[model samples]
Target: MRHLFFALAPDAALRDAIANDAARLHLAWGGRATKPAKLHMTLRFLQGFTDPLPDDVVAAARAAGDAIASVPFAFELDRADRFGRRIGWLGCAVTPRPLQALHDALTESCRAHAVPMREEERFVPHVTILRDPKRAVPSAIAPLRWQVDGFVLMASAEGAYEVLGRWALRA
Candidate 1:
């Protein structure tokens, strides 16, 4: 069993923009910025499991991905926030309804497959950009608008992740 989750990775152009902002923030506040390659918006975090993921679980995830009828959606980052002393994340002031719908669909799919998931009363969509920043400051940078067209199922191990499947959002 392997650790798995569903996430949305930005295209190269958008990744570059986010990375640039992270670099600037790092210089100003002194923290570890997220690596350019590791930046992503997590849709659903499925906790760790054994090495080979069970076939039923993978099928369920695929079904969930297939159920999503949402088209491409856009979200914009409007502020930088610190969750605590250690975590600095980029917050999206705009909540896209489509994103929520996809998340809900995935959650329901997990229930259908009996896959354990992280329980949360509310889902906050965020992309972490820094860690252990010395200081938190108001972010006045231009909003980073991201156009999300698809999502990927990723397997994580030893602090690294590999994309196992890509699902496009369609009508």
Candidate 2:
């Protein structure tokens, strides 16, 4: 059985910057901060399964990822907000079209593979910064830039992620 999802991971330098910024936000908002190593922008979430995914499903994912006709795209994190009383997130003021396209493609691939996904009312792309927040503290953040080059398939175990596959974004 494996729990899997697809995400775009930031490089070490950018991860550091996001960690530092998240730390500052935690200081002000009083929440459980996200661990630096666990930070990633989720593209699509596939729930757990009790058996190995078929080879065709994995191949579909790989081919879908490879077919993303995009160069690297940049995004800016500009605000912090809460999903409720518990989860805190960094919001982007601007999301590139390529990013959205990549997400849509991955989602379509998952559908094609017969992978079941949760029904989310809306898709708001953001990185989680904290959990179990004390209160709602929406704060303006300095615009932080991220250059996304590729996305990866990751398996989850005991609150950590193991990378299963990676596909670069190229046109």
Candidate 3:
């Protein structure tokens, strides 16, 4: 069974910028800075198949992906914070409406198609920048703004992600 989820990732330029900031933060916080390739904001985590993912499940997920009606949108992350003691992350000071709408649309579409959604705590849109930091007190950072035009369905294993599908947000 593939561990699958939907996520939005930055372009290489923005990724490099984020990685650089993470490196600087790591020097102060003493932790592993996230690799540029692994930086992303998770949208939804889907249930894993008991067996290999069946064709119908894949179809339902694709149908859900295709049904999203959100257009390209932008958001900014202006502060750094930690989750527990391990996950040092960058997060928006406020959740953008378009981001929430997109998440809601995806949820509704998945429900319509009978795709099982993984149970998770309340969504907090964020991107991990460092892991196992000595300490990451809430601090202001130069804003990292993202123009989100598309998202991907990914299969995760062995610390890598494989894109199963990519969908452009509707305009």
lDDT by residue (60-94, candidate 3, tens digit) is: 88889988877899988788888999899888878
Off by over 4 Å in 3: 49-51
Alpha carbon lDDT of residue 86, candidate 3? Answer: 88
RMSD of each: 2.0, 2.2, 1.7
Q: Considering lDDT, where higher is better, how would the candidates rank from best to worst?
A: 3, 1, 2
Candidate 2 lDDT over 67-112, as tens digits, reads 5566777788787888888889886756567777878877877776
* lDDT tens digits by residue: candidate 1, 1-171: 577888989899988988888888888778888889888888898767887777777777767666666778787877777777787777666567877887888788777767677677787787788899888775646888888889998877666778877988765
- Native RMSD of candidate 1 (Å): 2.0
Q: By lDDT, who's the top model here?
A: 3
How does each model score on TM-score? Answer: 0.88, 0.87, 0.92
Per-candidate local distance difference test: 0.79, 0.78, 0.85
Kindly report which residue stretches of model 1 are placed more than 4 angstroms away from their true locations once superposed. 138-140
